[model samples]
Target: MSQILKGGCYCGGTTYTIAIPDKLPQVVGTPHKVPTSILDHCGKCRKTSGSLFQAWIVVPKPWITITYKYKEGSGGKLVEFQSSAHGTRSFCGACGTNLFYDSSKKKAMVEDMDGVVYLVNVTIGSLDEESLTHVELVKPKLHVWWDHGIGWIKEAFTTAGQGFGGLAKYPTGDVRQSPEELI
Candidate 1:
């Protein structure tokens, strides 16, 4: 079951669609990890997003397309910032919305298929409301760079000897009681 996730920047200046295709055969030699979304807790991500962690919908460069426009009707690509020697972060200049992180440089390549270099780590929060509900559909299977995040973040998300003390979970917007309350 593949999905097309739609997203845009705060001011609607930037829009994109991520087409997640169903799994295919691994024809490339050597080990390769399937392209799945991820929760990145690295310091750079946190600093760039001003969030504790950043949820990324990882997609091959070919599977996504982006469009952006300015206030005066100047449509252009995202403003790319080279945050690291091998990586870059792109955002909408109009509204300052962080969009994607690219790490296609061969020097920093860790997991990629043969001839496949670029992967867009799309900011999940930028996705539309309907796409947000399809969180499970994106298949964000890994939590990476957690060691660089705050200590509590890891504890709350993982078993970590203690049970989940993370963000409280409520089924809906209101803080309504569950199970017995409804019954």
Candidate 2:
């Protein structure tokens, strides 16, 4: 129950089953709690993903294992990209499906309790919605690299209909408490 998690890419050409320990290793676990972000990557993500942003859940690399085939091309050949300083960007080169980023080899000076190399980020858009909904594994609480985010996105997520100013984090426990009272 603790080690198995599943997900895949947009076209299903690339699928992944990862093995994540209950206690993730250091580099992987470090970013999980402090508002790990979903980056629209200023418009780059829109162009690359052809969507709003590069939606991903950053987790511990060692906690994750590449369990399935990550292939590209019409022939189902191996597709990979030497992208980013942190890791490899893999996908179905045939369809250009953004599959996964393997960041385990990326150097992190910090040591983790699990003592494993970490891969870190996974695209949330590629995962199974039914599974994601139950776990809440990838709902982004904060948006980063927004200075370059889509123009309308800020307006959409930040629309002030209920007198909410759209700060990054929201308060907890009370729904009816007046803003003034809570503060």
Candidate 3:
């Protein structure tokens, strides 16, 4: 069965509920650690977010849902950046919240085969782990772009079993359906 997962921004100005599909498509990329502060590791992220790295999950676009009313704030709507010609990142205007990072550029970018759509990654600091314990379904699988990560984060979660769990040996070759089944 499918599940409804709810999350929102820091000020509660925006709220979202995503209908997670029961099956996740198999992912095609091999998990690798990279030395970078942000996946979209560039000057834009550092200046906008005032942080070294932005926490993100690389997922397909179809899986994301942003509340219509909350799409923008008093500052203005999120200015999407074509980080690369193929990827996009959305950031909040008012508070500089790093909202979403998606690789889907357009319908033309979508692939024919079934695969995991998007990353359901949330801001580690933005979320209250105790409150969302049950809903905190997925942990960081492979810490990509480790170069930009805060020094403390790596040192804290690096312990083998402390901050990791779920599947043994992780999934391989693009998910065939929605990750809802695993949840």
Candidate 4:
């Protein structure tokens, strides 16, 4: 069955819905494939979110709908920042909350996806807190950029501080999908 996951900025200035297909596409570039989501610890993600790690839900561009509203005499719209040569970031101008990470400039991990489309990743934290109760549903299969991660923070997570679950860790990127699956 399909689902439309709801999320928005902290100030309620921006809102969006993710149309979850019956089968989530391999929208995230892999060696980590079919996660439909991931926990990002890359430097870019850290700087943008001002957090140690950022959780993201990945889906095709066609699957997401974004709306902007004006509030408090402010634009109250999503401001786009070209954070990287291959990626663009969007956040609420009113409250400065990072919401969307656009990877259209980057190439899909699997070359043979059948058609041209880009992945639009959303900040999982922005999703309704109630929807996050089901851990497995939003759990990331891989932790990317581990080498750049802080040690104590990593240990706190890996050594069973509390509510810990083991996920594959990759220092640089992630485990790629099988060669056959690429086509």
TM-score per candidate, chains pooled: 0.74, 0.63, 0.52, 0.75
32-134 in candidate 2: lDDT tens per residue? 4411336546454465567777877766555554543534335553377766565566766455667666654643533434444343567776677654763
The deviation in Å at residue 44 for candidate 4 is 1.7
Task: Write the residue-wise lDDT of candidate 3 on 13-64 in tens digits.
Answer: 5445544445543444533321111243345554555666555433344554
- lDDT assessment of candidate 4: 0.74
Off by over 4 Å in 1: 24-34, 73-77, 106-114, 159-183
CA lDDT, every model vs. true structure: 0.74, 0.57, 0.48, 0.74
Cα lDDT, model 1, residue 102: 87
Report each candidate's C-alpha RMSD, comma-separated, in the order given: 4.7, 9.2, 13.1, 12.5
TM-score: which is higher, 1 or 2? 1
Error of 2 at 1 (Å): 4.5
After TM-score superposition, the amount by which residue 145's alpha carbon in candidate 4 deviates from its true location, in angstroms, is 1.1
Report the CA-based lDDT of candidate 2 relative to the real structure. 0.57
**Candidate 2 deviant stretches above 4 angstroms:** 1-3, 10-13, 21-37, 67-74, 83-87, 102-116, 161-183
lDDT of 1 by residue, 54-157 (tens): 98876667768787555676544588999999889998877788999988562223232355546578888899999888756555778888678788777677
Clashes of each: 0, 11, 26, 2
Worst 10 residues of 4 by lDDT: 26-35
Clashing pairs in 1: none
